[model samples]
Target: MPGYLLVFFCGVLFAAGLGLSGMTLPQKVIGFLDFAGEWDPSLALVMVGSAGVYFVFYRRIIRRAHPLFDVSFHVPTRTDIDQRLIVGAALFGIGWGLVGFCPGPALTALVSGYDKALIFFVAMVTGMYAYRTVDAIAGLRTDEGTAVDG
Candidate 1:
């Protein structure tokens, strides 16, 4: 229950930060992406500020015995880039460029009852489900092939 409360509080804080930073507006994000035209550097500034904060605290947090809530920190182990990673990154970039709303801001904007945010969220969820379905099917096929060989 405490863990859930902490997570909820963090989520609220994140949403508030996004709203305060003008990140909930698709137009702002689109403006930032428009380098040839009226390019906005505010988002870049926000990114830099966030990175600075993380840089200041990330090492200290990691050096601790464990997180306050979790038993261990689940950091990513993989450092190698692959074709799948490249393709996924490209798709993510294209989606962000087209809609001007990534998952975080899109979810945050949904509270304002924006139709575009709702549509984007639905499409994003559908894409996630589609990926899971395809991955599961591929895994089953691989398992069946291994069983047949053994």
Candidate 2:
């Protein structure tokens, strides 16, 4: 319960930060990506700030005996970047470049009554479900016979 509370609080804080940083706006993100144009650099600053905080805390947390609630840190062992990973990243990049609404920002912007962000969020969720359906149909699996091991 405490871990869940902590997660909820952290999520709220992150959403608040995004709202305060104008990251909830698609125009700001698109402006940042348009380097040939005026190019808003605020998003870069936000990324750097987030990375810095994560760097400091991630190391500190890993050094502890274990996660406060979990028995062990949920770390992935897969180091190889497979085709699925590459294609997924490319798709994400293209979506972001086109709509300027990544998952986080799109979800946050839902409160702002932004039609485009709402559309993007709907599309994103649809895409996830579509991928899951296709994977299930294709019978894609790891050597362990798990539906999701990657």
Candidate 3:
């Protein structure tokens, strides 16, 4: 399908951008986090550049009738910050600070046969599955038996 192909191509492009930006390297990310030590501000440029581009395009895309691939814009309706969000964000930050490998960079680095990347990827996947299992078991429903967002 064209949508699937577009998604694949976009993923490749994203991976390529991460590689070219030196984001696939744990050392680069760690260096950026090392404020009291040898800090690398170069990654900030990459972040800012990405945010700027997304800011421009996100506005333009939302204004359109619909996306090229989807019938509707899949936007989050939830606005209130809750315990689940805080805990998840804290965990993500801690993992990123420790391994210096978020999902995207880790996946991109996996192709280069990086052992750490592989390890992180496995752990990340396990964590995701664990969360899903727990969430499924502990899922909350309303009086009408409709699933509610946490």
Candidate with maximal lDDT: 3
Which pairs of residues have clashing backbones in candidate 2? none
Candidate 1 error regions (>4 Å)? 133-150
**How much lDDT does candidate 2 score?**
0.81
* True-structure RMSD for candidate 1: 6.2
Per-residue lDDT of candidate 2, residues 1-150 (tens digit):
999999999999999999898788889999999999998999999999988998989888888888988898765556665666666678889989997888888888888787777787898899987986665565643334323332
The estimated TM-scores of all candidates read: 0.85, 0.85, 0.86
Clashes of each: 0, 0, 0
- Candidate 3 clashing pairs, residues 3+ apart or interchain: none
Candidate 3 off by > 4 Å: 133-150
Model 3 has an lDDT value of 0.82
Q: Model 3, 50-111: lDDT tens per residue?
A: 99999989888899999998998777666666665666678889999997998888777778
**CA lDDT, every model vs. true structure:** 0.80, 0.81, 0.82
| lDDT tens digits by residue: candidate 1, 22-124 | 7888999999999997989899987888789989998999999888989987665555555545666788899999989988997787788978788889999
TM-score of candidate 3 on Cα atoms, chains taken together:
0.86
